[model samples]
Target: MTEQGQSMLNRTVRKRHQLSAESIAKDLQISCGLQISITAVRRELHGMGLHKRAAACKPYITKCNAKRQMQ
Candidate 1:
């Protein structure tokens, strides 16, 4: 459990992309034969200060910016 948690923690913290807890739990079950739950994966990730978040979006798109971007 701990080794899996460590690997996931490293990946979530160091990588530009993130994996969902459900997928991680599936991987742990398939790759390592550990039948852990999504909640467990979330708990483990939370222990390492990782949390799920959505990518930030810009609310405003100015006409000048759009014109420049087309070029």
Candidate 2:
């Protein structure tokens, strides 16, 4: 990514802290005409000290919801 692109990426990340690499890549493509791969986005994010964390575990159904469904 160019310097401007990198700055844009930083700005984007700052503005939306929960965006994924694929979405960020698509944003860059749409907003700035900067075509980048997900890997590149991830690399840039890593360089910026933004590392990915494992997703939190979620139950398929909450206990309360499951009980309600059974009624």
Candidate 3:
């Protein structure tokens, strides 16, 4: 995995929080100088099992969004 990828995972664990793939990808590009897409970030997070967690307000929203976008 890329250093940025590792850092992303670490941040998620440290914060016990998850961010959207777009947010992570933007951070990687702007902060870490890594040019990657949200889709790539999503794939990486899936491989790491570190993707966004369910939210209290709309528990399945993220999953639904992912499915829609992928479709």
lDDT score, candidate 2, position 39: 95
Model 1: per-residue Cα lDDT at residue 19: 56
Each candidate structure's count of clashing pairs: 0, 0, 0
What local lDDT does model 2 show for residue 51? 78
lDDT of candidate model 2 versus the reference: 0.89
- RMSD versus native structure for model 1: 6.3
TM-score for candidate 1, residues paired by index: 0.55
Q: Write the per-residue lDDT of candidate 1 for residues 1-71, one digit (tens) a residue.
A: 57856785456446535658877767667765777788887887787777897769976779998888898
- Cα error, residue 69 of model 3, in Å, equals 43
In lDDT terms, which candidate is top? 2
Q: TM-score, each model? A: 0.55, 0.69, 0.54
CA lDDT, candidate 2, residue 40: 93
Model 3: per-residue Cα lDDT over 1-71, one tens digit each: 67756776557545645568777777667766777787877877787766566736855558779899899
Between the candidate structures 1 and 2, which one is better when assessed by TM-score? 2
Every candidate's CA RMSD: 6.3, 7.2, 12.2
Full-model lDDT, candidate 3 = 0.69
Q: Global lDDT for candidate 1? A: 0.71
